[model samples]
Target: MFQDYLFFGVDTKVHYSYRMLHLSHLVEEAKQLHNLNTNRALLLSDALLGSVLLSSILDYEERVNLRFHCNGDFTIGTETSFQAETRGYIECNENSEVVKQLDLGNNIIPEFQVRSMRSQRKKPNLFEGLTSTKANSLEKALNEHLAASYQMNTVLKISSWIDSVSGKLNAFGVIYQELPDIPEEVSIKLKKHIDSLPSMKELFLLDNDADVLSKKLIPDITKAVKSINPKFVCSCSQERVENVIVTLPLSELSDILNKAEDLEMKCHYCNKNYIVSMQTITQIYASRNQVNSTNSNEMN
Candidate 1:
């Protein structure tokens, strides 16, 4: 099986930077975890690739989130940590006429509201940007976000292909950012180089090492500065599920406890189910009241 990796490199002269990604295995894992149909898989794959591309700008321990609101009924979200751990999901109103009529295979939507959020591990502040595009292209929207938010010159390309025989998805992308103070001629040459290359699908099909591919894209990439393996990692856990249950209103907790059946919670990102037994719910309910009473007594 082919592993997924992201390679970071810079021009020999330090005039530009590059990030190359090979995410087919990671995307396949997501497709299986979410049990997505072809169209849903394609959209999620694109979102995943786009999110990783944006991660190039994140500092260590920081995270970036990408959300796509399609029309009014469909939405997709992807999150990637600076370490390249990624998770994403697709959501839609299954009964909505608009969602039912959407031909996602064509990769065309009437409109998309793209929002990006960046934050550090323990930071209280978040940096967010929102952009709207009618092009029905996630690539274009992401490029717009980078330009407007970071004021950097970047070109991003994401491509995905489905294997006809194995029904597997192969997806990858490249991010090229021209460093500040780059001469106009150098910038023009870089653009021409990117344009003249083969399609992303073709490049990915070669199955070349990420470093080798980076060198192909930017011949001046003397050495790789960073290499990361991105994988599908979900943050959901039983304790988190219990915390969610504890936050419910007394009535809701009572209703669930009265049922005498385990409450099942499913993670949106990985579709993993966590079962909260009635006994556990009752314990949490009691603990919630105990904590509240302790606070009340302290105030008194």
Candidate 2:
């Protein structure tokens, strides 16, 4: 069973979270949309898991977005809500030489960006960290980001099993963070205790269960404070897309109106294509003009 949750040590000195995803289906859906090969698909899976762990600590209305800009074959990104609904994608030129020799670790420096996803606010806040891919692992890069950017003493573990032949994926992972004001020696002892546990890959192979693994790792954890079920969810829809189309500058809309029978817009997150008919385009134009006219009159 797919499971996601947050738990804390009995004394609340440390916080932990985990996610187990039967990612084959979601990865297949992504592969079909983005034409992902094994390596690119694998990168996307890692980003998703990272996003899930990062977002788990956020407030209900807040969301976290993770973006990586690298010299690898692909620059991967993910956005996840506190509820654990996540979407991710990879950006790259398939024909470039870089793609031919794509290695996630080849990049000298990569930026990890975290941002607020709220739109109604005047300005959203952004926090970012920079790290080198010298170690050639996203996990290490992210741990560095946490330390450097947020000053958080966090250990992030991400793991996945993918079929080489089919490119199918199964992923699971966890994050542990030492809470502030804890004694340094206690922190060291606790971290060492955690380090002694099996790696995520080893744990998955042995039990395939997050709950069982969590208890083994932190026996005195508080009862599940919250339970979350995360999935691949997209926020694109016809009406939402239509609203965006209507906001485009009139000149751009006119170019589309004159040359194209229908406008095709593809979502960057899910790769869903939406085709807006010419009639809807004209209607949107009319509606925009009406709003502008009303505003002009009000100003007069």
Assess every candidate by TM-score.
Answer: 0.84, 0.75
Model 1: residues >4 Å from true position, as ranges? Answer: 101-104, 206-212, 219-221, 246-261, 279-300
Among all windows of 10 consecutive residues in model 1, the one with the lowest summed lDDT is 99-108
The candidate that wins on lDDT is: 1
Model 1: pairs clashing at backbone N, Cα or C within 3 Å: none
Go through the candidates in order and give each one's C-alpha lDDT: 0.83, 0.66
| Model 1 lDDT per residue over 195-284, tens place | 888878888668566655776787454567888899888888999999899889877988888888999999888888999988898898
Tens digit of per-residue lDDT, candidate 2, span 36-116:
766677677777777777676444435677777665545777887766777888898666565655544333333333322
lDDT (Cα, 0-100) at 257 in candidate 2: 89
RMSD of each: 3.1, 4.5
